[model samples]
Target: MLKLNKIFIFTGCLLVILSIELLLAQKQTKTYRNYHFVYDTADSVYVKKLAAKIKKQLHQIEFFFNYKPKSIITIIITRSDAEYTSYRGKIMPEWSQALALTREKIILLKIENADDIIRSPEILLHELVHIFFDDRITTHKIPVWLHEGIAQYLSGYELTVNDRIHLANALTSNNIISLTAMDSLFTFGQVKARLAYIEALTAIQFIVKNHGVAALQMLINN
Candidate 1:
């Protein structure tokens, strides 16, 4: 009986050790301020490179919104599109560089290589805005335009010449999308999605210009 009990104890300990090792291998974490990031060991260099930029952006965002995250935000950085899609559990649009699950306080980023990470520096900032807006604001009934607009605006996304040209073409062709229809813009193809983003940014600019920042802030506050 004593020998059998010793064997069971040894087996349990070995199983526990294996489980811990597996969990550790799957999730290596890096903490900066209120943001807690989980990524693979191989991507440590990439995460470190963006840490300073992310921290600075976070400060600016917090100051702009007058809000700090109440809890540590978990950001998961995936190594490939396949991994990202698996984590998201859906096929995202080509234009979707990153995503935020506001209620869950999670952000997912797909970084395939150094160039890919450097090419879209604003991607994480844009997602951060979504997390901040949803968490900081008290209302849940906000429009998609407002949500996306704020994210783009705060992320320093400006309508480029190409964007304006696209907008002009859209206007001339009578293909301009209405605010109501813009809610499903992400589901559209790449060209249409780009146009939708341009339109949204312009709408936000219009609101800020005509009503002043305070007025738009008041609207969002409620």
Candidate 2:
């Protein structure tokens, strides 16, 4: 009887050890090594790269605001055009924007996922300007034009005669949406309309570059 009892106890201990080993193996399998990421599968490298860039940019912005920014901004990056159009169109009726962070530390997915474009720091910086000033503004009365134009301008996207002609055509042809009504002009059709968008972004670029992002903070405050 004593021998049988000892055998039973030893068998039970072995089983428990095996179970723990299995659980540890499972836990190890579940762990993901990459940091600053939520998505599975590596289809888009640009998303990963841009996320790092955005983090670096935020350090400068926090200094600009003179506040210790405490927030974990999460961005879900998607490459599907249909997904892009649906999200962007639903929010503000446009789809070509590269980056946007709403008032709540929630940035809508950056849409420009093209490898070449995503690599451009200027485009991300343009959106960062909006993120910085938008968060600083307590009230929500600023014209939509301010955000969009500032984004376009600071992004370093150029404007020329060809873009002007396209925008003029959009306006004269009535293809462009009403300037007063366009809450955010991310997806204007005519080339000229886009040029106008570039111009708006540049205005932001100008303000920050010359007057300062602080000026934008004041603009939003007032």
Candidate 3:
């Protein structure tokens, strides 16, 4: 009789715990402007701010792409590196702060703390640029380098001083990489990935400088 009572108490506690977890999980989701954002209850304010920023960025992306993606987008915000890695699985690089699965229209972002919130806008915009390009351009013939270049360029990602230094060193050493070599940039480790991104950004900048934005747009349209 005493043993039965103990077992029942343990089972009741277990059920209560599961119910609480389910409620918490349900509270994490919020929808805004066709975007479904998921984050912890503690991040409610952060998610609201992010959703507002996304709405503004969406206009910027539409202006650049000349089209808006009509599909619903999902943004998952992870609070730690471990959570981000777990959500992304093996396909994510250790250095990646965010990832956009364009096919699925999902963006996964890792935010360490409140301090990291400032970086979220650019990261979110960058991923949205990828999604916009993928949706606007139906052809699979677009090169990976060009795809990433467009995303970085449209997201307002400029080359930093460190990127300039890397480019200078690569140029001086005659070790500059071709666009084709950058096709697998994300697969490479951190150092190589950074260089590849800088190179791709510069490539798009060069095109814009030499041929102008119209030329770039024409190429994209074709």
Q: Which is the winner by lDDT between candidate 1 and candidate 2?
A: 1
Better of 1 and 2 by TM-score: 1
Query: What's the TM for model 1?
Result: 0.81
lDDT string for model 2 (28-129, tens) is 111112212323255346555655655565556556555543455434443456644433434343435444534433333444446634545555556556
Instruction: Please identify model 1 stretches exceeding 4 Å from their true place.
Output: 1-25, 91-95, 113-115
Candidate 1 residue lDDT tens string, 1-222: 979966765664455334333444577899987888888888787788778766666677788788998898778887788766655544346667776767667777888886768844578888889888888776467788787887887777778898999999999999998888877776798888888788888998998899877766787788
* Candidate 2 segments whose C-alpha is farther than 4 A from its true place: 1-36, 43-48, 85-89, 98-104, 110-125, 153-193, 205-214
What's the TM for model 3? 0.82
Candidate 3 lDDT (Cα, whole model)? Answer: 0.78
Global lDDT scores for all candidate models: 0.76, 0.51, 0.78
TM-score of each: 0.81, 0.55, 0.82
Candidate 2: minimum summed lDDT over ten consecutive residues — where?
26-35
Top TM-score model: 3
Q: In candidate 3, what are the lDDT values of residues 36-136, reduced to their tens digit?
A: 78788999998888878767657867887887667798788888987776666555568988878776787878899766798787788888888887788
Per-prediction tally of clashes: 0, 11, 0
